[model samples]
Target: MKLSDKAYEKFKHHLMMGDLKPGQFISQRELATMTGVPLAPVREALLRLELEGVVQIAPQRGIQIVEVSLRFIRDTYQLRMMIEKEAAAKFAGNASEAMISQLREVHRSVIARVDEVGPSDNLLKDAQGIDDSLHDTIVSSLGNELVDWLYAMNNQRIQLIRLAHGHLTLITPGTFRQVMTEHMAIIEALESHDPDAAASAIEKHLTAALHRALGL
Candidate 1:
């Protein structure tokens, strides 16, 4: 990757890991030193993050991480619900056997680890990978480049917001099991090639997740 891309990923990782927390003030000089990237590339990365609405750039005050408000949560979930519901239906109709098998294996691996010692960091990372792959595969099946790009951008922001709130890494036994169950439901719907059922399952999953995020 280019230097600027590397810088962007490094900065984004810090944000996602809560090192640079929501509403916290940071300087490009400090970030450049922290990420070990040059000032120019770091500045470009910061501008890109600003365009994504993930940070506020100020000449004098310093960059402030964007706060995750209830309204932001509401609007984000609303948009996700609309796109994912449709994506699920399309995936049910078009996904190949191999694709279905890949999702099934991910689900099985996650469920199998639930009986392990604990939800270790590796386990949580596995679960996160499953979540990302499943959703991206479904969305990509729609064959709309623009929608894919848009959803990816929105999803990245949501992920960072979750990370900022410490929700992204919540891997308690209960939460892990709940996530496995929900993913299994969607996988079942897709395997059966039932569009309506797939859509309904996705709706239910996203709705429940939104409620959890809102602490409802």
Candidate 2:
């Protein structure tokens, strides 16, 4: 990847991993040092993040991480539901065996690791990865570039909300397990080739996620 892209990924990782708290202010130089990138690339990364509303730049102060507000959460979840419901319905109508297998494997992997679960950063990251993969698979199946782009942007905001929430209370291992179970419900509904069932499952999951985001 390009240096600027590397800087952006690293900076985003730190932000999502709770290394940088929401509403915290830090210098560009500090971000450069933290991400092991040069000042120019860090500046480029920060500019991108600023445009995304993940952070803001000030004249005299430094970059300020954006705070997650309830409105943002509600709006984001609404967008998520709009896309995911349609995607799930489509997926149920035409999901290939390979697609079902992929989702099933993701769920199985997370469930198998339940014994090793911990409230550590790595565990959270791993869970996030599996969750993202499952959702991305469904979203990508729709073959809509615009929808995919919007979903990706909203997903980042959701991650920020999750990180902010983690600061208040640790997400237990049971929650991750429950998440995987919820994912399995969607997968099962899709595998049944019942559009109504799949859409309903997607709606329920997104609704629960909105509730969780509200808790943030």
Candidate 3:
């Protein structure tokens, strides 16, 4: 990777890991040191971050990380719902039975494990992966690079928002199970090759998630 891209990735890693906080301000030199990259590369990274609304760079006041607000939560979830709902419809029309079956099985397995043994740290990790895979598969089904790029940018913001709200990673076992159940609903719609049902399921899941993020 180029130095600037490396810096950008490092910054994103720290942000998602909660090492870098939202609404915090740091100088370019400080960011460079934190990312272990040269100042020039860090500057380039900040420009990209600023354009993505991940950070704001002021002439004299240093860079400020995005602050999570109600509007931010709504906007992020709105974009996600818009993209994934369309993708889910497309995926339902084209996805193979075997792929849909595999998704259903994985979700069922996770829910069963949670029921039997309760949630472990490892199980939670597995649950997170299962949650991510379904959504990722749906979104990638669109096969549009520009849409993919936009989704990825918005996804970073979504992760930051989730981290701030303690929704996904810090979820309770019951809540995690509920999420898996929701995924099962989406998968079932896909399995049936019902595009409208799949899209509606995606919208319902995302709306619930948005509410959770908003603490409503």
Each candidate's lDDT (Cα)?
0.83, 0.81, 0.87
Q: What stretches of model 2 exceed 4 Å from their correct place?
A: 105-129, 167-171, 174-178
> Per-residue alpha-carbon lDDT of model 2 for 1-216, expressed as tens digits?
999999999998887767998779999989999999999989998889888778989889999998777887788788899999999999899899887987788677666675555446676667777777777888888999999888888878877777777532233554666666678899999889998999899898778777765663
**Candidate order, lDDT descending:** 3, 1, 2
Which candidate number maximizes TM-score?
3
Candidate closer to the true structure by lDDT (higher is better), 2 or 3? 3
Better of 1 and 3 by TM-score: 3
Predicted structure 2: lDDT: 0.81
TM-scores of all candidate predictions against the true structure: 0.86, 0.80, 0.96
Comparison by TM-score, 2 against 3, better one: 3
Candidate 3, residues 11-126: lDDT per residue as tens digits? 99889888888888889998888899999989999999999999999779999999988888889889999999999999999999988989989888988898899898899889
Summarize candidate 1's per-residue lDDT along 1-216 as a digit string, tens digits.
888899899988877776888778888899889889999998898888888778899879898888788887788889888999999998999999898998999788777775766788788877877877788888889999989878977886687657755563344555788877888999999999999999999999888888878777
